[model samples]
Target: MKLLKIAFKSAANRKTGLILASVSIALSIMLLLVVDTIRKQGKSSFVNTISQTDLVVGARSGPLNLLMYSVFRIGNATNNVSWKSYQEIAAFPETDWTVPLSLGDSHKGFRVLGTNQDYFKYYRFAGGKNLAFAKGKQFDDLYDAVLGSEVAKKLSYKLGDKITLAHGLTSTKFAEHGDKPFRVSGILERTGTPVDQTVHVSLQAIEAIHVDWLSGSPSPIKISAEKAREMKLNPKTITAFMLGLKNRTATFRMQRKINQYRAEPLLAILPGSTLAILWNTLGNFEKILVAIAFLVLLSGLLGMLTTLLSTLNERRREMAILRTVGAHAWHIIALFLLEAFMVVLGGCILGLIASYVVQLVAQPLLVQLYGIHIDIMFPDAEQWAIIGGALLLGLFFSLLPGLIAYRRSLQDGLVLKV
Candidate 1:
């Protein structure tokens, strides 16, 4: 206790250099915490983008490719699955639920998904969390539409707002279905996933829009929007689907069955495993971020070491004063160790607070810009271990200066040499 008090008082007298060193460490630590947090949270949010579903089924393609197009809305499907095949599979005894997805349309850069009410009831994401509506209810009428969070905000759409979808994935006024505009009936809550960037409508509505089209072009005999709505609509094909089986153990068997399906060539993938393959491609990028953060931390440690060594010459008189008061050689060393410990611990505390604040500010921005949600949280056990290791390492490096001061104090005796 006495040694700590004396060391703290000594540090206070030379507050400028010590404070600067501590701030350097704090900034470095802050960066490390932020980067590590983003890395972890970003990966978690990415992995849990879709959950609970046992398999993702699509037209035959690479597992990674299917996972990307089916879940992340990236790329295009080589072929679409027949509605007959979908119905037959959905009626399988092992299948618990399924959600059909028809893509290849867009509205103002956001993908348009044609689906059924089964989507909202059976689809899950972020660890089985259900899709929720922020305003209004699900689509009921033939021309009713549902908007995702980002779509509603970006295009300033509201319930009852009219939205026309482009024929292809590219948003263009030329290929837009202006003849059959959809009315926004519901806006889904913000999910911080790809769902936020999608526009959803019933598969029937999708069929109605292209009823009079022949090979992706308007037919010479055009059907008015009213007449199309009155006609029964049935989608011929869908891009992909998600499946949840009653028994998880049946996943592999079902995947194999789908792969060898006779009605049509199909592919089924485990969402978890396929997502792992997708993120593995980003493993090197994650390592690069961590490496950069550690480099900054190394510089901060060097700053602390330099600051402590530079102050040794000035602290010599102080060390001599302690010796005159019966302080032993090791006590002088202990003093520096205690001072270093104080600086390191204090810096870590400040860094944690700064990191928390930064996360609070960054949460909305990440959601808006990248559709990733980051939660603010205290350092976990691993992070605590990291901080404790930093404290011990700083104290270890402070020993050289402590030994130099100890040796000089004993050699010079009680004589003061400026």
Candidate 2:
């Protein structure tokens, strides 16, 4: 108890120096946690964006490209699958359900998706959770549309509001289907996924809007929106589709069959396996981030070392005073260790508080810019391990100065060294 009291007194007397060392470590610790938290939660939010589907089927292309375009709405498709092929696969004996996706339309920068009611029935997210409506029911009419949460909020749309879609995915307004404006029939609740940024409409609506158009523009011969709705609206082609199998065991067999189909080049990817490959591709980048974090931590520890070592000369008189008062060499060593512990513990706690503040400020921005929602949390077990490791390293490095003070006190007992 006496040793602790003396250590605290000594630390309090030099509070300015100790505080500086603590703040440096605190910032380093905050950076390390932030990097790790972002990497982990970003990967988790991405993988859980779409779930419960066994396979994603698209025209022959790289698996990552297909995943990005179909799931993330990030890229354009290389080719589209014919509706004939979609029907054949949907009818496969092992197929339990299918959701067809028709892309290539936009509304004020949000992608427009053309899908049937099966999308509502089969699509799952965030661990088998179904899509819930925020305002109204799904679109049952040819001229009805369903707005994702972000689309509705950003455009201030509501039920029965008329909106037109542009021909291409870009925001450019060169060719728009203004004559066939659709009324908003539904608004989806926010899921914090890519779905929140989409405009959904029935497959028939896609064909109806394009019936009188050719070569990417309206032809001289045009059909009125009412007249087009009266005609057939079955889609002849689609950008991609998702399938869920009845028997999990037959997933591989069906994937092989789809890839080797004689009708046309097709690709079927298992979402879980494809995601694993994606993580592997990014493994090196993650390692680099972790390495940078460690370097920052090391610099912080070295700062503490430098502060302790440089102050040893000034502390020699205090060590001689302790020896005259019957303090042993081991007690001097113990006092320094206690002081180091206090500094490290204070820094670790301050780092946690700073991390919380940073996350609070940045959480909304991350969601807005990247569509990645960070799960707010206290430090977990692994993080505790990191804190403990930092404290131990600080204590370990402080031993050098402690040993110097101990030997100097022994040699110059009861004497003030000039």
Instruction: Count backbone clashes in candidate 1.
Output: 0
- lDDT string for model 2 (1-418, tens) is 8889999998998898888888888987887787777778878878888899999999999999998889878788999999999999999999999999999999988889999998988888888889999999999888999998988988899999999998997655567998899999999998878888889999999999999899788888889999997898889999999999999999999999999988989999998788778777876788888888788878877887887888887788899999888888788888888988898888889988888888888776666555667877888888888899999998998899999899998777665668
Q: What are the Cα lDDT values of the candidates?
A: 0.87, 0.88
**For this target, which candidate reaches the highest lDDT against the unseen true structure?**
2
TM-score of 1: 0.80
- Minimum summed lDDT over a 10-residue window in model 2 is located at 364-373
Q: Clashes in model 1: which pairs?
A: none
Instruction: Give the Cα RMSD of candidate 1.
Output: 3.9
Error of 2 at 252 (Å): 2.0
